[model samples]
Target: MDVGQQPAAWHELAATFATIAAALFGLFFVAMALHLDAISTNVTVRARARVSLQSLALSVVQSLLILVPRQPPLWLGIELITTEIVYVMLGAGLRVRAGITALIAAMPIAAGISLIAGHGPGLLLQVPAIIIGVVLGCWQAWNTILPAELQTRRTVTKARR
Candidate 1:
């Protein structure tokens, strides 16, 4: 068991790889179930299905851009635009504030513009993007964790049971 050896030399560990893959698949399925449950009331299952489809399409385009040596410019454009559109739709569906959503929506476009500009994105823009993303993420986490009436209803519901 030489730890420094490459993955290619681990061909004999097919069973271990299979076990890991199975575990990862199970985790992914469980996550999908939780996600579906969380959004079921506000978003219809069919709408969720459409979102998944759109996401899959964008993922394919992104993969091509990353993996292909000669990825088409059109594919990159499609991937970038579709991703932003999907993010915006998801943010609206989840009732996030417009300002926060707008900032999040602009992130990729900002990065793309910077890349196209050839000099690359400055640290100034990157720093703000990171800070904005972290702040918005924390705000959303707090909102989800402490919903209005959650504390009041929880105590009453516990007493009833």
Candidate 2:
């Protein structure tokens, strides 16, 4: 696949990414709802949840940009970079782990920039990067919820004792 050509295959890949990101977002929302009490009681857990949501949101936007009909590469690059900056800033205001994850999450933006500049493997690199970001986001969200649930259970057990 030529980097200059926007193939149907590439669009299909982007659409698949969008679907996955949306599904992950829905799952995260359900998990948060189920653990709302634990999440609300802890600032760190809340920040982690926020970071996870932001990452998933970024994945959806990036995938949509790729799927957009006749979208210019320059616009995609600009939007992706801008989104990464915003995400990193938001993470910086949270815990150190979130800030680190935010930096890792921006890897896709760099790949997107390379694609726009026509230097990279185009859709091949972009697709993987987007998927990785979504996975990382889901992992972060799980990390947040699981620990909180365990802590809550422990607290209940102790109180009963």
Candidate 3:
């Protein structure tokens, strides 16, 4: 199959992805900052926040790699896999959080392997992967911003009234 032939379309997609990923990171950062105390003191919240940022940062890196001019499919694939490796490694001590990250990284990892093999959905797979990453990141960010205890407090307060 022909690779790198559809540069124009892929570049546009990648550029858009990079833009969205960066913006999401910014929002997540603010959320993390707002709950800094909660996150620092709570291991779970801290892990979630770390995963959120890790996911967003990986998405940005993936998008940038995808945007590289005339890059070979195998090279892109290797890069994606390598990035995921680092992501997994970074989440190593997080236990279940790392599992969650591995699941989320699965799509892009598969897409990368597929690209390397010159078959399958190729770059298109990353579209959903990117969307998924964004959602997961945002979810974790929200959790950081409002941990369960805070949410429970709000609920109890409301119930009292």
Best by lDDT: 3
Residue-by-residue lDDT tens digits, candidate 3, 109-135:
887888888787777776777777777
lDDT of 2 by residue, 1-161 (tens): 36533534568778888898999999999989988889988887888888788878878888887777777666666676777678677663254465556555556567556656866655555666677678778877888889888978998999999
Q: List the residue pairs that clash in candidate 2.
A: none
Cα deviation at 131, candidate 2, in Å, is 1.8
What RMSD, rounded to one decimal, does every model reach? 10.8, 3.1, 4.3
Pairs with backbone N, CA or C atoms under 3 Å apart (clashes), candidate 1: none
Off by over 4 Å in 3: 2-8, 92-102, 148-161
Provide the overall lDDT of each model, using Cα atoms, as 2-decimal numbers: 0.41, 0.73, 0.76
TM-score of each: 0.41, 0.78, 0.78
- Our tally of clashes for model 3 stands at 0
lDDT of each residue in 1-161, candidate 1, tens digit only: 22211223323342343343344334434444545434344344334333333333333333233333444333433444466676566544245456755665575456444434433441223234334443443343333333323544665689999
Native-to-model Cα distance after best TM-score fit, residue 79 in candidate 1, in Å: 5.6
**Which sections of candidate 1 miss by over 4 Å?**
1-82, 120-127, 148-161
lDDT of 3: 0.76
**Backbone collision count in every prediction?**
0, 0, 0
